[model samples]
Target chain A: MARAIPTRRRWLLSLLAWAVGLIIFFPILWTVLTSFKTEGEAIAAPPHILFFHWTLENYAEVQQRSNYIEHVTNSVVIALGSTLLALLIGVPAAWAAAFAPTRRTKDLLMWMLSTKMMPPVGVLVPIYLLFRDWGLLDTLTGLTVLMMLVNLPIVVWMLYTYFREIPADILEAARMDGARLFNEIVHVLAPMAAPGIASTMLLNIILAWNEAFWTLNLTAAKAAPLSAFIASYSSPEGLFWAKLSAASTMAIAPILILGWFSQRQLVRGLTFGAVK
Target chain B: MATLHTRSLARLMMAPSVAMLFLWMAVPLGMTLYFSFIRYNLLIPGPRSFVGFSNYYYFVTDPAFVAALVNTLVIIGGTLLITVIGGILLALLLDQPIFGQGIVRLLVISPFFVLPTVAALVWKNMMMNPVYGVFAQIARSLGLAPLDWFASVPLLSITLIVAWQWLPFATLILLTALQSLSEEQREAAEMDGARRFSIFFYIILPHLARAITVVILIETIFLLTVFAEILVTTNGGPGVATTNIAFLVYAQALLQFDVAGASAGGIIAVILANIVAVFLMRMIGRNLEA
Candidate 1:
């Protein structure tokens, strides 16, 4: 049933596709380009499209003005820490639900997902007060725990979907071959599920890295991640467009690269496997 | 295939996630419910007295609440409309065999990964600045005055930023769905002399129904709480023009230090979100059964 497309039609379609793509990508492209320009050039009358004196001065200034390294460290720790915690809690839960089904399994999974639907604002007061009472505000540990809780359901859901894809017969065969429970898991199941686990980790890190609500609310100085750090630029400080763009670009670059690599898994994780 | 021994092991394995999720859901929700019924303000540390429904009453009666409610609806509706329609068109275009398709796809999907604060700031300063922004430059080149986006139309501006962030998500999911459409089905319809519009309406649209619903439902949940975008850009400014329920609650609780009033607003937001959550849960529940 497959047919080759005509050359002219394909070329026309390509032109249209590229045009739309460029327009959609223009904002980010503009930001990256502006990051290399001077403050004056960034806000020039006719915005410099391509021809501009590029310099690393903005990047240097952004770093000199703020503790960029501290924020990046916080972002890394929170994203990776929360992702690891979620995986630790999520893997076992997903393995159980995927490998051993009960009447309540479906209901339990749905309930977990419904928790995600509960808007964070609904619980903001209690959590904020609790954090205050316990002196947990502006601490990396507090944020890590919160992010883990926020992303736990998605982690479990994605892992469950991935684990279900692995045939039960293979596990049965391992069991029949006199493999012990730990050996079967460590030797067979882990290897089979490695790709799924990797993608889930990638997606969770990206999510936690970019999570704004809690990070913005709970963090002030000591534990602020890049999200909050970049938000501090909202109050303009004397023609700092280039510096802001530089900070913004640095904050988002790592996650953006990871996101591109895991585009397929993103649909699966966010949608709870509804689309895929 | 599940034996009793296996089921017991499974229960043991599922305990940690289940227990934590239960506590996470129940504890704060119960506290919010309790707080909504009392007179509690962080600023005044007097003995909190039980006030039945007064908190909710005052919160609902506030003029800002009405404005926030309307802004929330508008932002959600506007973002959903733009993302879904634009997603469909983009998906259709990308479905065509094109040159450098990989690079094009990468370009289109990049915005979804941009952090909200970064996206909002980039839009506010670099693109929407009334004086020297690209939009201003374009308008002036054509002999027109540039509009101050946040000052004039704050909610719509926030909606545009949120939509740009989400459009990539919708397009990617819908395109995945579109790619899964069977080639034989399309060829059969074509062999029957179906026009392009007819094929789209009769075949493609129905196939994309589930993906579209998923996009709408997920987007709605996120859009209802459009916080950081407004926070970084407008801070719900220009006379509360862009304050959604989430931002209003935040202002009440954090900025104004009125805990009880904010808790009441929080409860209202929960109920509104649950209305949408019910339908989405049903759809996903049905999918699970299938």
Candidate 2:
């Protein structure tokens, strides 16, 4: 490490890293691989590490038994619905705080974040009561609203961080070019901020998709997303590992792909830009 | 040209979010506080008279309260211990110039994306199922009796699952911090004949302290609320053996339908979270000023 000019040491380090990485990743890999194995093979004594007779029966059976598509659609509606709504609210607030240097802006941002700090359980009783009274319990609309508010602070904070980085000169020139406020935001501001907005959206979707507390407590069969989908399998009666594996694999696949692209945003968004 | 007008316009832009967040925060929280001081259980259906601090007193004095509080600490403490120490070691390994590092990073961070319920269920059924789980199979293959994970060491089992989910987060953040260390700093240390341990303790460890703190605080915020994992695996099993304060409050509110008592516990969780929030706010607030 001090002076890296040796091939042998480099090879050894790579092997060690790969070995550890594989260990850290084995559970996920095993889940995915098991999705293709039969129930017996899945729980085989030696445990088929990969050489099982691969089949799509588990996937088909998972869909047949659980209506996987409905769960998938619910997840999309809740995750994207909440994320887009958060953006609808978050983007302008971020813009206002970023472009305007009001003395209270920092306080405003901090206060928004403090809303996030209020643990879900703290308000669970009230929210649950309210939802029950309003007939909003176990509805996609209800979950969307809850998820939006749950992640609203993060959405605002992440968007603000992105918006603050947009150079002022472009907006200035657009204004000088006789662009009205509406046109300025539509043409000039939107394109420049689009990447940041997109990043914030992706991150929020990831958060909303993986949000377990509200998703679990609030929804039942109809409105439950993938979080609840997998939780539904927690107490399965018998010989369901293959199906559980298949369902888990499908539930995480979309978000996992999305998550792969949002690593940088994750660090920034969660940290509230603390590290950077 | 029109500063006051634009400032008001800016205020208008931020108004909806702030108002909604305010309403979202104020209504339920205020409701929780109000219920905390009153006698309100869905099942009991009575005059709903004010109970004063009795709700709080009963809740704190409940035998489950102590166990839950201790378990909460164990989850946070255990997860933090695993993630931070494991994270530092992993970060060091990852920070090296290695082949297929990008693939390795992906493999490492994949767990962070798995929903808690899914992760817990998968771990419980597939890996820790004592009867057919991989861990059991491995233990049996070694001629050792399979340990029933949930029946024994339930908290540690949940802690391991939580740690597995969060280890990637710790690794990624710590690795980000580690990469920021300048090579010149290390080379200079080497020039001074500092050994690998000296370089690590002196050069790397000091640089990573802030990141480690960030990891700890952020993880603590989430870990204190570890509900789904516990729910999916043990259901706070073997008689409140794995129940943390969150699940305890949840059981009180939902299972027992004791709204006032659960509200009291909820308020305590809020207070506990707020104490942590104060620190996080100060730290981030300082960063914002800079």
Candidate 3:
């Protein structure tokens, strides 16, 4: 018996879902809207809900006043750089953990995960001191290394999950055919897991690009990413709504586009290895 | 010889990453533990002395520590409540027949990819500005008084916004679980004359138990350490009402340059997080085992 929800109940549920979704997404929508208003109109009394002159002046000011390109470049370089570094390190490590498990492999994986559980601030002072002493403070290399290390655990974990999904028999077949270990992984494993790897890289790059703590703490000017670019607008000298929104929209636009396009891959990848 | 060579090669491939992560985890943490036991402050640079547990003593006794800890707990608890409930409800709804579901899902997931600083700035400036925000606009249109979200009564509105950014994660995970559920079992319940509510409560909810646990554990780990949002929006402000331990430690170390005190506070936070993490990991491990 196929029992169907009544029309009224279905309508109610749909309306409720739409309302909740809108409420959750309102902030992002409001930000984009405010970016077009004048500074005065952006923070007008009773709030300009709809009636306001839309202008690109705020974006022009944000671009003219701030070194938007430098931060954008820094964000791109660091996010891509750290993600690639994490992958370079994570791939082999995950390969070993997934395929060549020893008595201590699980323990090792757990320990690696526990490191992520530790509060980042617990080590911030030491890292800050270390960075300052090593003269890596405010350097792209410094942020790259730090972000890479922080994001490595997730990379390894995700890759391990993906690797576990590949049948061990295929690798055995390659070995039986006299393929070298490197050739086996390169040919058999890498291609099979490419989708997972690509998604992992995308996710990690997003995480790194969005990271704010180390970027704010370690880098002041030269290595500041889009995160820091947004933070600068948060001056104690009162808020600049239009310009702040403009900067924020600029900062998130690229990742937002990426996310919109790759939503399927992102969702599938994250849930794929976990449920099974 | 080839087998041995392959194993050794595997070990060799793993060594650099292992060693780097090993040092990355140990060196700073080792420094934190050492610093916690010593008398050290950046402003008062001198020969440091080992002060067994006084730093911890002072840190635990400080009201700032208490405030920060409580705030951390409240935010974590508040976020967990909102995300879990909201996520489950949203997932259930999205699982229903819907128009433009993919686009909705993408919009819903978009916030999670947003940079924390940008999200916070967007919320603080464009949405929660109290005066010129959409919330105020709606309130005025509805003939109700507008409320200042960051002020007296609803300081946590910003925290909720930050938590909202993460809600999609919980929804996606849970929704995946929901979709993977055995349809035959649902039909069995239907045949058994189980009411819709009973079917959901008895069958669907239990099927989602594992997903819920995963969501709770992953979200808790991140929520306990939420920093960027607080830093950008509140700065632990409006009278330290929003200060979590991370921000507190940051202020102590960077703003005051009190390395010893900050280290002590940091250790305390680590201990607390570890307690929750242990339970969470155990649950996940057990779930995986099952």
Instruction: Calculate DockQ per candidate and list them.
Output: 0.86, 0.78, 0.56
Interface RMSD of 1: 0.9
Model 3 lDDT per residue over B1-290, tens place: 23666667768777877788889989898999999999999889798999999998988898878888888888888888888898898898888756556766776777888888878777665666667676777788899988888886444876677677888888888888898887789989899999989988999999998888778777777777788888877788877788888888899899999899999988888888898789766764554345
Clashes in model 2: which pairs?
none
Q: For residues B97-147, write the lDDT of model 1, one tens digit per residue.
A: 888988899999999999999999999988888998888889999999998
The Cα RMSD across the true interface for model 3 is 2.6
- Candidate ranking under lDDT, highest first, comes to 1, 2, 3
Give the best candidate by DockQ.
1
Model 2 Cα lDDT, one tens digit per residue, B5-116: 6679789989999999999999999999999999998998789898799999999999999999999999999999999999999999988888999999999999999999
**Window of ten residues with lowest summed lDDT in model 3 chain A:** A267-276
> For candidate 3, what is the DockQ-based docking class?
medium
Stretches of candidate 1 off by over 4 Å are none
Worst 10 residues of 1 chain A by lDDT: A180-189
Cα displacement (Å) at residue B61, model 2: 0.5
Q: Rank the candidates by DockQ, best first.
A: 1, 2, 3
TM-score of chain A of 2: 0.96
Query: What are the models' TM-scores?
Result: 0.98, 0.98, 0.94
* Tens digit of per-residue lDDT, candidate 1, span A1-276: 336989999999999999999999988989999999998899888777789999999899888989798999999999999999999999989988898889999999999999999999999999999999999999999999999999999999999999999998898799889987668777988899999999999999999999999999999999999999999999977898899989988998889899999989998888887887
